[model samples]
Target: MAIRDWPEGERPREKLLTLGAAALSDAELLAIFLRVGVKGRSAVDLARDLLSSFGGLRQLLEADRQRFCAEHGLGEAKFVQLQATLELSRRHLGSLLERDAALTSPTLVRRFLSAQLRHLDHEAFAALFLDTQHRVIRFEILSEGTLDSASVYPREVARRALARNAGAVIFAHNHPSGVAEPSDADRRITERLREALALFDIRVLDHFVIGDGEVISFAERGWL
Candidate 1:
């Protein structure tokens, strides 16, 4: 049914005023942002079409600004509203990240690293910096090569961590061979880095060996 013809209590705009934005369905939320539809379609109809085009709100939010604006019914103005809404969502995610910086266990570290590792042809070692309360401040790529101590200098990593004033770190590197298990070289490098960073009071949370849709943690194996 068209929004204006729907029962007043069930309409998205009205319900938002009475029950808040969180109470609305996905289509209702998008419809409110969309405001109008093209030709014979209502705002809700256009919202449904956009959902089908992008595979739902999460996927739509992850899309590039240009791609969002390129949709047939989505002109620049409507796309800008969608982009602003998604930007607000990102800020919310950032706030959540800041409130809980601690990686806690290996599983959480793996979950966090999988996205960055999913598409890599070579090893990419990264350091995730955490604050005093264990909230993540930022992350940096330390090195990229075949997982070996000679390639990834512990001293260099230590220097960078000290410069950033990183309280804790969770190190991760992708395995091109799609094996999450650590190699002998990988273990040695992690051990050396752990020892070197300890002197600077930089706690090593975990070392992740990322595979395709999988990860192995050194700390979880009692190796770190």
Candidate 2:
């Protein structure tokens, strides 16, 4: 049956309106995005099928243009819509970070950085430059390539920190491999950055290695 044929309270849109977006299931949320069904299936049914085919919402959202467009109910338009939505969420997180002091809001920092970095296909190194009070001065991508220890330059990091007049910094890098475990190379690089920044009397507050689901922090592990 079509979604309209369902009982109003049972329908995805109605349920969302009555309760809240948080109350909706993944399939229900996706059904709202889909908005219409094809041929014989209801929107919810198509959403369920897509979720199953793609393995979940995250996988579907992260899917590349060609792979996403190849899906039965989705196409380039939907892919574009999804990407725009994702970017908006990332920017929202960034705005939140901008409004708050970075050190006082560790969880928010992790969430913002995780959302920004987790979906990248290639490794990226970023810095959250902070003022003396630990308020964020600027967030910048210092380098982009295969994220290994050797690829990130300590001098470049120092230069950027100096350029921003940052009193301290929180470094972050993504592991495209989805493993949050900090490798020995990761530790070595963190130490090197700490030493380089130390010469200018700047502190290396933390180094976060962003992985699939978890962010590992050198400071949290007492490795800093």
Candidate 3:
């Protein structure tokens, strides 16, 4: 049956309005984005098929424009809409981080960084500059590199910290290897950055290594 023919309580849109977005299944959430279905399939069924084809919601969202547009029932417009929605979520998270002390919401910090970096095919290093009150001031990608490594310059990081007039910073980098374990090089780089920033009286709050399924924190492990 068409979604319009379904009981109001059972429909994705109605359920989202009556219950909450979190109460919906992954397929239902995606169905809302999809808006409509092709031929005889319901929107939920179409979303389920897309998720299966792409291996899941994350993979589907991360798909390249060409790849995504080529999918049945999806086109350039949907791809554009999806990309916009993803960016809006990122900005919303950043705004929330800017309102609170960075360390006070460690889980939110991890989630924001993970969403920003986990899908990258290469290594990238970013810094979140914070004010004296620990509210985020700026987030920037300091360096980008190949799959295995990225060359991070302590001097550049220090300069950016000074430029932002930041009092503290949280460092983050993604491991394309899908392993969150801190390598010796990772430790060494963090120390170099910490020392360089210390010269300007700036503090290194924490360093995070983002992986596919885990985010390893230096402070949590007592490495900082």
Which order, best to worst by lDDT?
3, 2, 1
TM-scores of all predicted structures: 0.63, 0.96, 0.96
Tens-place lDDT digits, model 2, residues 35-142: 987899989999999999999988898999999999998898898999999999999988989888898899999998899789989988899999888998998988
Error of 2 at 29 (Å): 0.7
Q: What is the C-alpha lDDT of each candidate?
A: 0.77, 0.91, 0.91
Give a tens-digit lDDT track for model 1, residues 102-197. 664334545556655545667899988876666787777788877676788888998888887788888889987777778888888888989999
Residue 217 error, candidate 2, Å: 1.3
For model 2, what is the error of residue 83's alpha carbon versus the real structure, in angstroms, after optimal superposition? 0.8
* Backbone clashes in model 3: 0
Instruction: Estimate, for each residue in 1-224, the C-alpha lDDT of model 3 and write its tens digit.
Output: 99999999999999999999999999999999999999999999999999999999888988999999999999999999999999999999988888899989999999999989998888899999999889999999988984222488888889899999999999999998899898988888898889899999999999999997999999999988
The reply for model 1, stretches above 4 Å from the true place, is 96-126, 131-155, 171-196, 207-224
